[model samples]
Target: MPLLDASRDLIAAAARRVMARCDELARVSAAQSGIERVYLSPEHARVNRLAAEWMREVGMTTRQDAAGNQLGRVGDPASAALMLGSHLDTVPDAGRYDGIVGVLMALEVVRLLRDATLPFAIEVVAFSDEEGTRFGKALLGSSAVAGAWDPGWWSLTDAEGTSLREAFLEFGLDPGRIGEAARQPDELVGYLEAHIEQGPELDERGESLAVVSSIASARRFQLIVEGEARHAGGTPYDRRRDALLGASEAALAVERICRAEHHIIGTVGQLEAYPGAVNVVPGEARLSLDLRGEFDGARDSVWSAISAELDAIMGRRGLRWTAREVHSAPAVFCAPLLQDAVREGIRSTVATTEDPAVIFSRAGHDGMAIGAVTGVGMLFLRNPDGISHHPDESVSEGDVARGIQSLAETVLQLAADR
Candidate 1:
């Protein structure tokens, strides 16, 4: 397939539109200072409405799915769709781009292809939840779309003690009908997402975009260490059984073990000691572990090594330890056909004779869930310094412009392949 006519001015104008829309959505935060829009919140509803309105302006029909995902589509309603988009949800104190840019870029792609003919329809989705900041579970929206929603998630509560079911009701949705959100494999040709690279790989290589090879396999756990509370002033080091000490040792062991393995990463993001009193030794300590790897066996093996180290630490500290598995997902690899499409799409925009860069995403994405039902592909725009999940995360307008063209071309490439 020949490339689309992506003139410099047209790309510049589209990039500005995408950037301005991003700024507008960033204001729909739950916080007063930084951006934060969680699932089933007022902000989510507002953004969905806004996205729907934009979709309508592009002559596409829109709907808010039972799972609260915002969707828009153009072309024949009966045809299988080429789905494009990313999450609309954000983490606490989030950057403007992470998921938002992808949604906007999807819209731009639809706009660019408005005059082109294709075999399948185009659908843009703004997934309601991917960060899982409120529900503590990622990919809820996409999982529902992939027919993988867990019934037990309804009981999961937020920090304010609002259950997921309750939040759904409050957001004007019926929990019983959530199954309506699932899309059969026959209904979709494939899924493609254009997102800001959450890491520095592209920026480090001085490239504008890259084709995503695969998303990492991940597991999360809540760990607890138990011990007897004692007086801080009178308890001797030999007599004290400190839960905090045991948990601390476990965290260090996680870092050491993960660092020794290739492409495995472990983080101890949350930690707390019970009784939180300066005058008393902690009776219990709780911490969270997020482990990810390029492969499932490697990720699981590292967890086993960490578990053995935790056993040794607890034994030495005279404490007891336990772990609760909260979440797990296997690695999702991109289809070779989609990967080639993405590569050619990216190569079309660059001036280089070399092939465009290819990368494996270490972070989680909705593709992890959608991959269950159909082929999945991703195009990543550069993120300076690899910063994300924070306010400082950034992408240049030029990169976004190229990303918009690249994604449009990718769709054409897919259409030609079909």
Candidate 2:
């Protein structure tokens, strides 16, 4: 019942190729040392070309969609297809395997199953953007596919003040044709994505992979606390209203409330004080609030309590406070049938009779956007340190090999039913 002893030669060979391709893709980055390929940039184009090349080698016809999503297909476009993919874009100073691994592993799955005529077509997708590095909004590529493109996104700009419409034109893509990316419900089967766990669950369980039960609903807010600024030496303790002190207490309240719950997580990831000086009492403070949970109702409930705590803190300190929501995404539960296939794949590939771990993903993904269209299923590869979105993100080759086999098996298991 050893987890890794069941590795096969064919799967290992395919995984070696997949990892080698990841190394090649990592070289196509905007950053010099670390990875930073964003949406519609030259690095993005280079990586797409590389992916198309690999797809062709596996008997897939390739093209980039209107929204710049790179795609490879094994059957006629007229036929319904099962989408398997992950984003190609990366955050600043990102690790190699966060999104790239899923795309590469999908190609390998196709390479393994190329000789067969499955019940449905298979499309390997390398989404153009997911990290939202250049554009402040995430899932630009997948959103287009899900037909969730907002007209307002065109007005969004990058750090350089270039509008999204301008960036699309610069990339030689027609923004007017973006609607061509949407896939209708009748046009395909469900989606399957193999990604790094981006957490410590699988590693902690000493397992190679796990099935995702649900993706967490998330909401973000910008909280601002305002008070009068005065000289630290001149302002009397009883007379002064320090915005920073109020913000500090609110952040602590968030942590305390979230920790008391089962799956809720609240983070004040960023904080800043105006006129940051040793002698000046802080007049204003701004903090980013990111909250997530397995259920939206529970998440919103916790947020309400946190808001009340912020209000109490502001009132006690004689400060005015305001909160504005920046983003919101509802929870998405995996289809029970797809979840079964994923579980079956894990058991067969790892040769383990032990029930595999099933966990909810607290981090958002392209699936959150894509789930608006079709059912979404995910397989999580073990990330030993539970680290992601950084240069240190990692997945062992052995685990990746297991991932390829499991993914291939998931497809085969579904095909058998079809």
Candidate 3:
């Protein structure tokens, strides 16, 4: 593979452009996701238009699907396409690089490819609603493309009771036409995404690149523990069935289970106690648990352990309880051929032994969603501190350049395949 000077310049320019728009985009994302105090707001339509314009500026033809996904095409429509891009939406108050990096890199790829002749078409996508912060549904755009959209999904409402369908209408997107976003199996020959590691794996190990093997299996659930409400001053410790205590016990069980299992992570991210007043005895508690493991059986074992612990705690405390499974996605392995290509891409970049390749990723990405339908590969640029999704997230300019080099090489190599 030959390195092109113009491609390097284009990638550098794209990164600079992204950095300049960081503050403005962050504010827009925060407001649209209604992330100040909630999960996310339905602002896919708003961001899609902005992304379309950016795509056009880079010489790519753009379009918005009914699912609110935006695609910018480079190369000929008749050729097999290699799609590169990421989601545009952010987590509530999320730092800029979470999803934006991949999207920008895709645009950069288009800009670079347009300057040269390529065998395959390249479609840069800005997928909508991958965070599930707004509609409680993750991977909305990718799911549509994968033919996984459920009619009932559009009927789901946000915390404020705004239906997703209505939100689409407000954005001038026809929810009824969402099915049109589905791609023919042959349309996408391969996919590549450049994303921040969003975890300590790369930084902690002093590795600059991560060729991901698989995405972790995740199970999300809500536990509701109910107990009698009483005045704090009037209730005796031994006589009261404290829901908070049971909830605490359950949380600890979750921690212990995760600690006992390798490559498994469990978090009780959200917890609410009724009568949160200091003087009142809590009557109800709601907690959300997110358990993940690299293997399916490991995840199931951890869930079982957690459930047993929750049951024992509830029984011992004499508290009524309920548990509901909210979402579960089995671990997904990246296609081996694509993985090998990514590895080759990494090796193609000249680097010191200090910048060796590593393989691990704890954070979920749009690539995981796309992998379900098509071959997908990812590249992780080094983050010295492994910090991401925050304002302080940083990556060296050199690493960015190397990553783009690797990406362009990989795309060119893949495009050469008949």
Candidate 4:
């Protein structure tokens, strides 16, 4: 039977309901962190509870783990389980769709399976803290499930000095028991996630879905520039040792270098000057650099060139600087077999409609983190403006419906596989 024909109205209705709940969910997420700042706030706990309720309403069993990940399941538990889910957290002031869409889509998949009487079991998960909005550590929930959670991570704190372990405990979860969250490697038959493009690639290409091949490798660092602070009026431009100026020049140089190397992408996302005074020449500047590329070697080479440029620029300007590497993760390629399933699923959905979906994703997602442990596949709905991670990010209702149908069909195909 044709999948869309069987569940089109239900899919469309679910998307509408998901959109309707966006404001409530967003507000709740904002409230959770007590910051009212980001989408991944303490309210995410509320969102998880609501998700569990919704799963129950749809006749699925649900549970919450030590890391606060909410899991809703249907089908037989004895067989290898197919997991479909996405993170529930978001960056501060994040748009409603980023991680929410994936979670909602997973729920819709469960609803569809219940309606269709599919033979295999499906698990829907709302992973916590994928955004790292409060804790500055991304993929913590997924890492826990992958058996990669570090007990030492309990010492990690947020900007406010609240440890993640503390937060987990306060939320009625035991951090020491996080190891129990890990899934047995053989238990997972496959995994899938749906997410916003979070970039211009899909809208620019006019595609409805993207079959992600690999996630870009990423490296983040802090560049600290130090120079003597002096009176702005007393110091001549030639003689002044201005850290801010040197840092700005180095940042621009980094941008120029990355632009020159088409494969590498770099951003100086944050910059701060110490002892700010309108009349003082700034003596200390800290710049945070986020660099990414599809290839590890290419990313390393870009970093090498950027380091060289920073050294040359600082030395010529008589400034002392330190570069501290903060975070690094290698690029992740989707399993070829799972990729094929995604392509087939998308093609099945397209066969039912005149307009086919595009297939590609450039943004990092929980799928990438989970792919490290199990077979992971992803599907993306069309975003007219290709905007994400902000209030302005959006996806059309038609596109969402198509993605749901495609995902449901894909889940069934994978579930039926021997």
Candidate 4, lDDT over the whole model: 0.77
lDDT against the true structure, per candidate, is 0.94, 0.90, 0.77, 0.77
> Which sections of candidate 4 miss by over 4 Å?
1-7, 31-41, 115-120, 351-360
* Alpha carbon lDDT at 342, candidate 4: 73
List model 4 lDDT by residue over 248-270, tens digit each.
Answer: 99889888988988557899989
Q: After superposition, how far is residue 302 of candidate 2 from its true place, in Å?
A: 0.8
Clashes of each: 0, 0, 3, 13
- TM for every model, in the order presented, reads 0.99, 0.96, 0.93, 0.93
Angstrom error at residue 223, model 2: 1.6
Cand. 4 TM to true fold: 0.93
Q: Pick the candidate with the highest lDDT.
A: 1
User: Candidate 3 at 102: error in angstroms?
Assistant: 0.7
Error of 3 at 12 (Å): 3.4
Looking at model 2, residue 179 earns an lDDT score of 94
Span of 10 residues, lowest total lDDT, candidate 1: 1-10
lDDT of 3 at 242: 83
* Best of the two (2, 4) by lDDT: 2
Candidate 2 C-alpha lDDT tens digits along 98-193:
999999999999988887668899999999888888987888999999999998899989999999999999999998999999988888788999
